[model samples]
Target: MKIGIIGATGNAGSAIYKVAQQRGLDVTAIVRNAAKAREVLGADANVIEKNAFALTAGDLTKFDYVVNAFATPTAYQHIDLAAKLVRELRENKTTKIIFIIGASSLLKPDGTKLLDSLLQDENAANWIATPIEQAKELTFLKLIDNVEWLAVSPQANFVPGPAAEYQLGVDHLLFNAAGHSIVSTGTMAEALVDQIENPTVPVRTRFTVGDK
Candidate 1:
């Protein structure tokens, strides 16, 4: 299958790109900087130099799936970009859109959202906006009914590391045997590709992954 990765140079996006290549899939990096994409993904990488927001339907329709891994310090841009992509793909269900969202929207065992606990932490102020906007993004996505979209949220602690055995769940926070909620970039990437290859979930729904 053909895939396009936005923010292809970023942590999650880069890992997904590499995993797609390892599977011998036709993948293209839709990034703003071609040189940096080449430097990071190697000289043989196929790249489409363009900003994610500026991408048009013609640009996105070339692939079977487009993965939005774009992240920004501004935080609110997460929802904005998701809205833009949904708007562009409205009523067009051929190319599926996959979003990488934050874990704050996942539910806890007590049926409370993880975001509720995160909001109570004073130390969360430094980077809490991201989770907040990501939660908002998921809410916005849920409201759209026409587009073929799927969202994946990592566990509480997402780190950059190699792939591992993972377990998947729908809209709840998952914990490992030790009770730690975490997942590596590689594991998330692997789950994403597996989902693309064998999609069992319905569109417009969200699922999560965690280290097993």
Candidate 2:
């Protein structure tokens, strides 16, 4: 299957790209900077060097799966890009889009959205917009029934590391053996590719992953 990963130079995207390569899947890094992507993913990495917003339906429809791992400090771009991708694939069933949105939308044990607490943090003013917009992305996806989409959310603390044992949950926050709501990039990558390869999680739904 052909897969294209936007933001392949980023942490989450790089991990996913590496895993896809290890599995010998036909994968391409859809990146804005060919030099940077080659530096991160290796010189021989299959690449589609272009701005994500510049990608048209024709570009995306070629891949069986396109992962929206795009991240930016602009914050609102999270929702903007999601909508753009959805728009490109509207009414098309052959191609699927997987989103690696953050954990801001997950529910706590008390049945409240994790975004609630994040909004209450005094120090969150700087980075709060990312989660807020990511939540909105999920909200937008939920309303679209025609597109084949899958949203995967990491734990409260998404860090960079290698893969490990992981547990999956739907919509609720998950804690690891150490009582920490954390997931490594490797684990997230494995879990995500697993779902993509196996097709267990239903389309148009979001699932959470945490280190086990």
User: Which candidate should be chosen as best, given lDDT against the real structure?
Assistant: 1
Worst 10 residues of 2 by lDDT: 72-81
- TM-score quality measure for candidate 1: 0.98
Q: What is candidate 2's lDDT per residue for 71-125, written digit by digit as tens? A: 9658999888888888889999999999998999999999999999999999998
lDDT measured at residue 167 in model 1 versus the true structure, 0 to 100: 97
Q: What stretches of model 1 exceed 4 Å from their correct place?
A: none
Tens-place lDDT per residue, model 1, 1-212, is: 99999999999999999999999999999998999999999999999999888989888888999999988658999988998898888898799999999899999999999999999998999988999999999999999999999999999999999999999999899999899999999999999999988998788899999999
Give the TM-score of each candidate.
Answer: 0.98, 0.98
RMSD of each: 0.8, 0.8
Candidate 1 residue 101 C-alpha distance from true site, Å: 0.7
